[model samples]
Target: MALNSGNGTVPDSKLGDEHVAVQKLQPDAKIYDRLMTLSGFFKQQYGDEPEFYVRVPGRVNIIGEHVDYCGYSVLPMAVEQSIILAVGTNKQRAQLELHHLDEGKFQSFDCDLSDLEIKLPKTGGPGWYSYFLCGIKGIQEELNDKWRPIGMRIALSGNVPLAAGLSSSSALVSAAVLATGHAQGMPLDRKQLASISASCEQYIGTHSGGMDQAIAYLAKQGCAQHIEFHPKLKGTPVTLPAGSCFVVANSLVQKRKAASSDYNERVVECRLATRWLAKSQKLPNWKDLIRFVDLQEACHLDNDAYVKLIDQQLKKSIYTREDICEGLGITEQELETDFLTPSTQHMQQFKLRQRALHVIQEAGRVVKFRQICEQLQRRSSKQDIEQLGQLMQESHHSLRELYECSHPDLERLVALSAKQGVSARVTGAGWGGCIVAMCDSVKAASDYVNVLKREYYAQLPAHLLERYQPNDFNEVVFATFPSNGAELFVQ
Candidate 1:
């Protein structure tokens, strides 16, 4: 696929706005087939040509793990796998039409545009279309009085593996926001789109750290972005060391972050720990400092000193409800109301110290990771690789032991990677998804993938073996470089 674009172009997307460049994706090879198929699907579904299209790539975090929500910076780059949509303004009726190619996992949904509501399930992940509605609703609520929201006809096909920590869900929400904003003639800002998408995804019920949404809109080709949330939301692109290729390997064990309370439980624990430490230190506004970043700043402690303070103050490995309530001079009802999210209201032990330590140290690793890459600046050396690789190794160990987010399958991949002289770590929200490994070169990546195929994927039981074959190596593991974020295409 080739993109005919004007300014920093892409191999896809079409739009004629001032902010985004308008281009056509010419169908010259198999890479362009998905776009062509989606175009045909749009015609068959809506009986008209699509006005424009949106392409949102999924991302793979290189080093930072489980620290984005703490209001810290994260290093992530966009991948080739993406969600593409064929969109046009609806004229037949005031209804939004959403169609997905995967009929087995999803069914076509249509809803009235004038009255938009995202209905979430009581348990498990919500329907796929519910996420799309989140984007449309986000834009609809934000638009000024000059314009009324319009219905749209959309047909989307995504290759990003679902529930694999690839942010396939955030990709859809962002595509919907971009497509809808374009249809409404709204001047779209990438940062605003990222912020809105992050806020709206809460409708689907997960308190995410916004790294997925930020990279979805802010990513540029050939470099990873160091996105920060404090002071203001911003992204800075950093060049990776020369002669390095990062390989992402799926563990084949899926945990939907929204479906389980484990993710939210961690978020609550971090918040509770922040408040516990803040109030203990006699900060006047302890309740206001729910995030670890805020607590650290309030205490006026450097990163190392903050860790020391946590060690000295948060002495217990686990704190019960009564323990926290008594220490904070609050009742159980207040703790339940102020400290816990609805999903994490279950009475339980809290690993305040461990969770706080992971966020603090992992945050330090992100800064160090970016610094090492910046220092290398297209240069390469054995010591440079060791420095960068060591950081990743430590990150995974911390996630597994301290954060308690790594899964057995993920650790197995990490182990196999270690044998190959590569450093791998659990990358996303982490309860069993993907491990991103640092390879010295492209050839090294290829060899590492082969090693994993024989040691890991090849040993799967007959049931899973039927799903992943030897020939489908790219599906299980592949080398990904930085790619363009979100682009719009005009027909």
Candidate 2:
């Protein structure tokens, strides 16, 4: 079925049960107003109105942190904030033209769709357009030789704070993929799009484990998704407790995964740990196994059994590069080329034990978190709810100490959240980002926000504080519920 047409209506047949409801555009609506503003900008820039709009929301991982790439389930919800695009297809031209709404922040770029090139910098991060190119190239490759690349004029605007541990970059990449697919008349399958977006992001050098892209396209309103990976991509809507809500607060300490090797280094450590465990088990094809989940499956062990394996096998807190190479029986060159990511190739040390422990234990926490949410639906009790909160706190501790991914600012925010009676953990890829705090009641959430504003945002420089008005403080730190996933708005 055609996913979208010139008409404003989106057929439900095109959107299967895996996707969220599609809404028609109304000019007077707030969302439409923003789209129109972007469309106007597009017209001014390219001398033509946009054919359609695409939106993909940023996500906040509530309970699971850094375990997604380990091939485990994660609990995350889509944020209302997202990356929005106004796109007009150019059938005659073969170049993709991109314009950022914030022109001063990101310079505009035009590239040939048929010959896309994404080059990472020797140091620092790749250009912003490199991310867009990742998505475009992904769609091109997914379609194979059948893809007749089309040129398009695009204007982009986003409210998801950049490098704030929120999936802003992933959302942008997803939006780009959606726009490119729609422009080329490709099928719109949420799962397939999520998979393509996930794989495409690796082009820019971050080995993200499909969580951001999954939640970006799979999320439904009013419920956090318990997304499971491994056999296949699936998301089950998990309604949060009635009395509690989640609030996301940015530390304002930007952490771009592409800019630093910290995120990928942890990923490498987990992979090495997985291989070491597999080798210890003498499992066939142990050398080929990279993900912890895959190793766990190979062992046919339960969560507790896996925890025991960690204790018995991964005895050391740290494993030097030499130790890993010796244990795996591979030369440094082979290890660097085959196992390590481009960014983490320079790292000489690996925290195999700690990183592996965090992955195994954190995966268990995710299962427990989903189970608690399921239990709450049948019976809500104070103790059961507190158990869930305690798990969140434990998850944060493991992330901070075991994974060594938490930053001081994030720790301070988590500490402040604890004092406010909210159980919080650093969300996203950590190192420096936002914290997802769980509160018991709406009143409690309001009070928590106030405390954070006074204690956290108030301490910021006067220039930074001046940017936010009294009423607009919620933009930086406020309660959020599950939002609808990606959608296309056709005119």
Best by TM-score: 2
Candidate 2, which segments miss by more than 4 Å at Cα?
A: 1-14, 19-23, 28-30, 469-472
User: Could you give me the TM-score of model 2 versus the true structure?
Assistant: 0.96
Residues 381-481, candidate 2: write the lDDT tens digits: 89989999999999999999998889998988998998988899999999888999999998899999999998988897777778765655777898887
Off by over 4 Å in 1: 1-18, 27-31, 144-147
Residue-wise C-alpha lDDT for candidate 1, range 40-136, written one tens digit per residue? 8889887889888789999999977778888889999999899999987855567888888776778999999888888888877888898898998
lDDT (CA) per prediction: 0.85, 0.87
> All predictions: root-mean-square deviation over Cα?
2.7, 2.7
Quick one: best lDDT, which candidate?
Answer: 2
Q: What's the TM-score of each model vs. the native?
A: 0.95, 0.96
